[model samples]
Target: MDRRKFLSATGLGAVALGAASTSVGAAPKTAAPAAKGGPAKFKLGCQSAPFDDEHFAFFARYGVRNCSSSAKILDPGRIYPTVDELKTLTDMGDRHGVSVDMVDSVLLTSSHIDREKNPAIMLAQDPQRDRDIEAFQTLIRNCAAAGIPAVKYNMSILGVLRSGKVKGRGDSEYLAWNLAEAKPPTPLTRAGVVDADRFWERITYFLDRVAPVAKEYKVKIACHPQDPGVPPSGYQGVDRVLGTIDGLKKFITINENPYHGLNFCQGTVSEDLRDPGTEIFDVIRYFGNRKKIFNVHFRNIKGHRDNFAEVFPDEGDVNFLEAIKVYKEVGYDGMLMPDHVPEVPGKPEARLENFAFAYGYIRGLIQAADHLA
Candidate 1:
């Protein structure tokens, strides 16, 4: 089916979809908006993939006041959430004094292309694309109803590609990705190879449909960059966009809606370019200045693009102190969370322990930056 027919049939056309507004009647119960002069104090948070009550307790214990949880918390088996389910989840967070600020999970079903599906449709393809868009719209509405501020998503068809684990500072295992060790790229769809242009077009199509809904709901849409790194060609199976600074600029400009921004993965950005330290600072300055950074995956890495080892925030190549300063200069007042950490052997609470360490380190940076300011 052609684009026009597809949109028409799916009721995605501007007028038709616009008429069926998804805004909820009641506003979510949450904190007051920060005053409009200088930057507001930012919150430190974490993602609980398999979100549960225990996760909240952990966050509360560590004095983490924000959370980015999996959409699975709402419908364990599906990607979408009903209003009631969203309310229940948010209420759970509230009880522990932690705010459910964002929700994320795998929006795409498969990592690689399946020959059984039409390449054209599968790439930007039909029913699935339509359903995904609707699911995202519903998610935005539900987030608004529950007072969640953002939805983080990734557009990469290839997903994350990691090679092996590498040893880190404290004899911990960190997931490493080296392009040399990476598997060869395969066709993303049965039709053949997907190009950068096509990948971006699909992304634009998604944003066009969803951004308006997000705006109406007052929920920000934050796109995650292609993880590991975006290859000169594509990585592991498809062309990756939004991996570099240029790509990120393209992404933010694609939709003019203020609600369209980034989840801002610091480690991924550091890994995407040749000079991570310099480039990462520039990225934060550029996006943060525009207030397009809705949240942050505040982690660090050992190397640059195509080959890197994940590391704790303090031990990486990037100067996170400068990172905090940049965020401050850009007036970013969003949640910053440690995206990844090493898994120490023989440690039952390795993740939590790593998080606690990261929390302390980042908190120190924020405080130090404030003092300098």
Candidate 2:
């Protein structure tokens, strides 16, 4: 269906949850408990980098109840942490009152994969494939032992690539990426230009090996989508998979284990479709209704595909209220964290300011949607 028709059918224009007028004046006030009822339908969370007591405290002050720690905190040198180390990190979360819902951006380094010359070789049938698989299994086991329910990761050899910046509110700098104006970097592996089929085959092999292990550990593997949208076939000397809906569906279908699911990055999926409203909502319902969404990166952008700027939750193209409504409709009870908020300029507490703004904005939306429902 056309974008306009889809918007009309989905009642996008009818959404009344406009931007909140109240400025985030100070550190967030402690949220009051729900009135004599069951638990909240969904929880608010954030991905704090350099995850530490200070960061957890900051989030807690803003009423965040769950968090995903930066992968670096778990494995500083990209070597997987031991079970004791993982438990220590979880203990830190308990002290701060924020549950560590997941570990963000877990990856196997070139050294662990044992393919320093071209780590992408590990993505295919390489001599070091066994080593790479073992590294991932160990990481998953340790995370599960430490009480982490999910692990978010990327399967692509090339991670997120952005080209430029855009001005946001208060002249804050937000990162932007335009594939049309960007040059593709050279392929990283000796086995260059792996086709889509080859990529799928290799991913299937990896999942086949890891899916059983994940089920055994009772931990979900949340596969993140390719960022900045996949380039046109062969545009970047590679057939980019997992950047489209079809690619994502294939990824999920390849492994039937309930433990294999999506990280459900709203912004990246919207960028791939190049429509942040209707298309984004459809994808949300598609995966969320099926319970394939393990977690969510709840952020928004001003544009789509290569030409986009991450903005405040309400200021972006996606109608977050409607998005939250869909999540409720689908019964998605997992963590939904604000990802990629632009820095507010000049404030000594710029990160805190941005995060507080996002947290308040999302919290308001969630409440409004639930009340309306």
Candidate 3:
């Protein structure tokens, strides 16, 4: 991202900027051929976690057009969202001119494994998991009935792991993970000793049940990858099978349904690589080309592999501007939203400020990339 400023100083940025403006302003009839998903249509989106009028208003103020919602309808009290409840979410979005493109709550999130809603689904437990899968399938059908195209969820026993937080850049605290500093408890999670083989068995069991339901309902199921993969020797007696690109490749092929894809958290993926700045674009291209990327958790990291800090997009190891270009290259047509914004000192307002910066920056990058090539 800093390189863009350097390019500006050298006049290259000006030239590209001008070319971009002209192309963007040109008639649509002059456009070039697009990839399988068709010409890239990058929309700025957000988690809108609460999905209340306040968050919806915030999105509208920033011109956000699409979002992954955690609307009240999907609250934990409810096992499956009623079509009317979901419509209420859309109606709320409609009032703010935002489309509720995706929802989470069905499979819960990447929260602690013990607190996860569908524990049986990940534990590979039968009778109970069957009920869980049935509810999930209903959620997929409900998404179709409600016109929400995707549902982002997590399937992890450990959830997101971190060593600690460190302060930086105007006193903002960064979420960090250094495996060397971690002292995972001996008992691990309640899931106990889930090896790679056992983990895959659990993952496939859930996918086998729900992939067809997703396909039938025409709802995309976006599974998030494990955050910051550790060494295979095992982390606290558990093996994370979905923490690597190879595992992810295997994942999409399991049920082999077009509706099955990823939520593509780039920062987490970078943590699994030796050199994220050099390696991420190829990864993006791989998924984007296959249309396996349904949504993106667009944030950056300051380091690679087992040790890294989740940082602002501009100062991370990966060049997000270049990454945006590659996303354009792959013809990705989905919400590219910020996921892990660091904690700046402004209390709740600081969080909003960080999100504002990320959303605005991403929107600008998308516009610039669209015009560049």
Candidate 4:
């Protein structure tokens, strides 16, 4: 295709060339989506990605660029990372050709509610939750001051759940979840017996406090969904409000700020439904069209809700090529990285090797999507 036709066909014709400093000390400009009216470019990014030199070398070896870091250079627990400290992280990534575009929240992530440091925020405890929320707000201010665009987080009380593992292609172990076979060490967690009413109440309380701060800082606070959907009767003696599609739909509307959105885990959301292959597209469109998806965990599954296995990108129930096209169709401009990968053994760098496959697979899909007629 000619340049003009290619641009028009792929919806890149009006994409304004936007640049933001992604490193410390008057760093070089990186081209990205404009603040407004530009086409949203789908960046291939990794989440919970490495930050150290050796790990950075691994990612750079495969040409990975933008990603959310699990780095503690600017930790929320110690002190609010000064703008300089935040820039220090970006500078480190710059040395390895990666950009630390987002950072995971220190106090609130996927940790079990009982094990959480910021439990007050999710537990509806007064004053203390307010203190915890203040720290997050401070982190947001530092992030914006340092030119970082987003902060990814989770409000998960139960964290992730899986029943067992099933052998997949090439003898890989796919993370499986079968409700019938599911077993918890105990009937309830310390958070105990939260109904949907109470769950929503806690969720809103956190949002009502944090959403305004996020908007003011222009930092996107991304929330991940509950791992696998549980029954209305509840699991582990707790109700997970973010586990269902209906619940997730209601979640983004609470404070209705631009910064409060989802981390959009495709794999987990796939595990939430009966038929992920067919049901996922509309869900993608619903969130994507609303411009609420901050980052995407572009992994896949092999079966439906309550009976599934987390599989590789290519050999899953969802047509990832189609999913990528839908992301393009809806102008999702963030990183699409793998969140969960099947454990396929026998490689020297077994874990990184699996991740490498996902990164390459994603790049391949993006290339195909870019040229498809």
Candidate 5:
């Protein structure tokens, strides 16, 4: 099937839910939109920076042009001058010749797990939900004021776990059957997990409330696909969100908003597609330029169904050549990060080395492609 047709088949029709009506302050007209240029030389970035902004100065030093960062640094509750602090960080990045391409939402992923354990953190639940909403709204407003372009949020509710301690590998951090301990081959149900209906209601409400403000502030909201390619058991009370290709399609189709986009994690979807290199072109052809794809995680796995390992970005089952070619063909200008690399041996900093290797390799691919052009 073609990319457009594939997406259409997977997309679920949905309506915007109780979206907030508040307006985000006007974006300054002086800030220019991203220029249409040839492919950018990709770079290596971490979801969380181990050190201060200074640690990432190496990106600019190496001519690595973009950095994908966590939105945590801009939290007003934790720190002050939140918006200016972010802009200053970005400005420093520009000074070093590195640009902040995307600000990933922290509230849902790791933060969600933390909230799950400490129910008080969940803003969507009861009295806390209202306060959480207000706090999050303030965050969005802060990001807008900082001139941050996009914020990606995930909808995974209960955390997935497999029972047992995972063994660590020298090449990577730790490859486990499940991040959480749980029985395998269990029956799956949408149940109380982040269901399609609940996701639509929450996301639509968020987008409707935030999209216009984001537009006014010149920022975009990108949602990531549910990881693991399956729903956590409803009976077990495990949470799952956007676990399939169809789930992702439902997210975009439901809102039917251009501002709504995706964080296309190749590894997660590869669990479903089996051959990552094969259907990727279709995804790009369909979601590309349509403005649905905002960021990409370039990782690979060994097996297709129910089992896999995170391998070196260069040596994975996914054909990087075809993937890069498809990305270029579709004019994808979004950030492509070498995600979840195997840890190197004994250095204690193997991830950084793996990231550098992937970054260099992808850059060479782009350069080679550009030469052919």
Candidate 6:
């Protein structure tokens, strides 16, 4: 969809009714605006995927306060917008009341490997790497130039994928989970087999090169865990860094810094069949106060690996109420981007609709809790 048409079609009307109008009631009470100083009022947002500038503009106009960028949207190859084009995006953000909350780099999993093998993937690896870690450096530069404060990166071996068998269920309920399957039936590169250690080294190397850059720009690098809690198999050729809780802690220990943080994805942690409250609270209690939690990907999931289904935030096993309470208690002022949403019916515009729904739901929850508190 073109920008103007798309914006007009799905713009502020969704939430503006409440935002722009005053309530008529017994006392005619007005909702308080989000407070500042003590803590930045937490906000609901979505990833910049299923791409459309208007879709994002709609979210912004509707009250979305933050965004997690996708590689599809930001990389030089895709949008390929010039410096002028980027200025246009910044102008668009200004016009729409949106801020680039977090700039996401390539998944340190498959995308990272791709970079190591293919020169094209070499984002700023000189000879092998780019001149200065090109893609990440570019992202940080754009964010800094745009006045964006943080950027999140992942360190999983494989990020998100569900089998056709699962997705084909269509009407039936199913959970997206990781398979304990091996990857790469045959060698794709000159290296005999890309193993776990090599992947970890490359990741560290990437971080070592890029973390300083992020620091220079004041962006936070949030490393997400490998979902499903499974290490890469021998036959799989794929490898993971943060496949387990211990792995996450270990990774933190290795790269200790306030700037190097975690993206606590509740659904991925729940895939371990553990209580989401415990997992989320533990991370926040440990990291949030330190400003080590760069952001969050909030969604509810049911069941364990090979048997998980995406559900509405309140419908799943995770305790979002407690999660939010913990978030507030810990002063988690970072962006809370909705991770996944079941496709809505008759909504051909999957990206914007889902994000709109999520934003509304989370906003209601947070406001309700704030009122009670």
**Candidate of highest lDDT:** 3
lDDT tens digits, residue span 82-153, model 1: 777777778888899988888873464224445232222236768777876787788888888877888887
lDDT (CA) per prediction? 0.70, 0.69, 0.79, 0.76, 0.55, 0.55
TM-score of each: 0.82, 0.82, 0.88, 0.86, 0.75, 0.72
After TM-score superposition, the amount by which residue 144's alpha carbon in candidate 5 deviates from its true location, in angstroms, is 2.9
- All models, RMSD in angstroms: 13.5, 9.5, 8.9, 11.9, 10.6, 12.5
Which pairs of residues have clashing backbones in candidate 2? Answer: none
Which pairs of residues have clashing backbones in candidate 3?
none
Model 3 global lDDT (CA atoms, 0 to 1): 0.79
> Which ranges in model 4 have alpha carbons more than 4 Å from their true place?
1-40, 73-80, 345-348
Alpha-carbon lDDT of model 2: 0.69
Q: Mind giving the per-residue lDDT tens digits that candidate 2 earns over 1-373?
A: 3334433543333433211111212322222122223334788888767688888888889889888775444445555667787777788889999898887533532131323433642356566676667778887898887888988777765557676665566657776665655665554334466677777787888899988898899999888877755554643455557777767877888767889899888877876654555566667767876788998889887666545666677777787777777777677888888887787556646877788888988888767756662
lDDT of 4 by residue, 201-276 (tens): 8888888888899999899989988887777778888777787777888899999988999999999888776667
In model 3, what is the error at residue 198, expressed in angstroms?
A: 0.7
Rank by TM-score (best first)? 3, 4, 1, 2, 5, 6
Per-residue error at 61 for model 4, in Å? 1.9
Worst 10 residues of 2 by lDDT: 17-26
Identify the superior model by lDDT, candidate 4 or candidate 6: 4
Error of 3 at 142 (Å): 0.5
Model 5 bad stretches (over 4 Å): 1-48, 71-81, 111-123, 159-196, 231-235, 238-241
Better of 3 and 4 by lDDT: 3
Where does the lowest 10-residue lDDT sum fall in candidate 3?
A: 16-25
Poorest lDDT segment (10 consecutive residues) of candidate 6 = 16-25
Sort the candidates on lDDT, descending order. 3, 4, 1, 2, 6, 5
